[model samples]
Target: MNAIMVMELKKHVQDRGLLFWMLILPIIFTVLFIAMFTANTDDATRQQVILSIVPGYVVMFVFFIMISMVSAFIKDRDKGMTTRVASTPISPYFYLLGKWIPFMCIVIIQVIVLFLFGRLVYDVPLGQPIILLILSIFLTFTVTGVGLALAVIVRTENMGIAITQIVALGGAMLSGLWVPLEMMPDFMQAISRFLPQYWAHQAFQDAMAGNIVFTELMQTLLILFGIGIAGFVIAILRYPFFLKRAVH
Candidate 1:
């Protein structure tokens, strides 16, 4: 089961389209964001803007990473590969892990790439590299569960793509991706409170500020954890096995 899962993971990574979605798109967005924000800023303004963006970027980062991972699962289920996986010693959880491990690695790579680019090109201060690393890992794992649930529940690749985009875009914006929670409208802020992206962004914001307060960070982490758990439960309980049945 482990061997099959590993092979399957490798096969997914080797695919050009999957690789682009997992790694390249995030990198592209990171560069574009940094460029646009820093273009007209003074030294101080550049630093300020970059610092502000850290949290939102983290949210968008995890969101985009999920798109490829979920799509991989959709493609497998579409092609009967998921059924073959089920017949093997591998269980649904193992299959989930197989899809997760690679994308987590991609997220880590994206973090390093973006962090360095921000520092060198945008003059963004690199604050506590260790903490940033830990934050990135935590965010990646949390999103993996969400992606797994999305893949399991979505009936078609097209629908999966649509759902992920909607979730990603809406969640990010509501969670203060385009604007911080403090600055957003009251209704948007209220809505953001219910979404996992809000808590995830909160975590990044707290971490970037160097607050390092365990209790505060835990609130955000716990909220994201709760979301992941709920999604996983739904996916496990409601996961469809038959293509025809799943469609209707």
Candidate 2:
């Protein structure tokens, strides 16, 4: 299983397009965001803005990462790679974990890059960036799991691409990516609570606020865990439909 995962990581790195989005795109957006936002805001206002914006950045990065993961799965299916894997002794869970390795590395790199850029250039204080890193990783577990399930559930690559963008954009908007929850319309704020992105943003926000409430924190963590587990369950149950042979 470990060998299979390593081979999957190697294959992903060799795929230039996938590697570019996973490694380059997020950093580009994050840098551009800092450039645009920093040009005019006062230092005091900047700190508060950072408090709000960091969570959004985390969410955006995760969204892109999920898209990359789902796209890779689609590519594997097209190339008959998944069928070959299915013939092996590997369980679906092991196959899934192996597939996730590259995205996990990309997510870790994104978090580290954001921390350095935020601290060095923007003067955003992250007391201990490690906490933020851990939260980002946990959130990826949920996002990647959901992405895999989508790959299994969708019939065509083109359809999966459309669904990927919709899910990412919807989650981002609902999680207050374009605007802060406190300032958004009341109904929107109410709707955001039902999305995984909201729970993820909440976890990051609480870590940044420096005053952690155990109940709030636990609730958010549980929600993310449930989402991840649920996605995995659906994928396993619907393997016949998701697997190419089932369609034939």
Candidate 3:
């Protein structure tokens, strides 16, 4: 498992497309939207807009990691890597963990990098660093768990890519990442409550404003955990079928 994870990490680091999607494109979106929205606002409103947009974009782009996750799994299966691994003495659980952990680590680093960029470049206030760190960790879990499930479920890389975009972009819109919940219709605001993205973005905003309440924070963390665990359960259950369909 450790060897698999290390090799995967090396591949991910060398993948320029992953770097661009995880880091570069997000920063570009953050800057572009920040400029567009803050252009006509006063200093106070501009700061408010920056506060909202920074975390919004962060949460949205983090889901893009799913694209890479899906691609990796599909490529491995097609190249007979899954068959080779299965023929080894390694446990399937270890194999799954080996594949999953690298993506999770990448997400954790991605979150830290994007947040630091916001802090250093945009001067976006990040209140309560400890709380923010905890939130980021769980957010990584939630996203990657779902990615794992998708990776095993999708038959083709393009299918996974299409679904990932729908989940990431559609979830962002419904979750108020692209706009505040208050600005949306009543039905949309109510529906946002069901999305992991909504809890994540809301908790992040509260943390940034230094408005952390213990109960609310726990609730958000638990919700994210529950969703992630569900995803993992699904992936584990479906993994046998995934292996059976492997090209080798």
The local distance difference test score of each candidate is 0.68, 0.71, 0.93
Q: Give model 3 RMSD, 1 decimal.
A: 0.9
- The C-alpha stretches of model 1 lying farther than 4 A from their native spots are 240-248
Error of 2 at 115 (Å): 2.9
Over 53-121, each residue of candidate 3 has an lDDT whose tens digit, in order, gives 999999999999999999999999999999989999988888888999999999999999999999998
Q: After superposition, how far is residue 44 of candidate 3 from its true place, in Å?
A: 1.2
Judged by TM-score relative to the true structure, which candidate is superior, 1 or 2? 2
Q: Write the per-residue lDDT of candidate 1 for residues 92-113, one digit (tens) a residue.
A: 6656666667766766776667
Q: Stretches of candidate 3 above 4 Å error?
A: none
Clashing pairs in 3: none
- Against the true structure, whose lDDT is highest? 3
CA shift of 170, model 2, Å: 1.8
Q: Specify the highest-TM-score model's number.
A: 3
Local accuracy of candidate 2 as per-residue lDDT tens digits, 1-248: 79767787787668787656654665576667656765788987767677667667767666666566666777777778788878889888777767766666766666666656666765666654565666767777677778767867776777777887887888788778757788888898999999988887777777776655668767877787788778778777766555655323
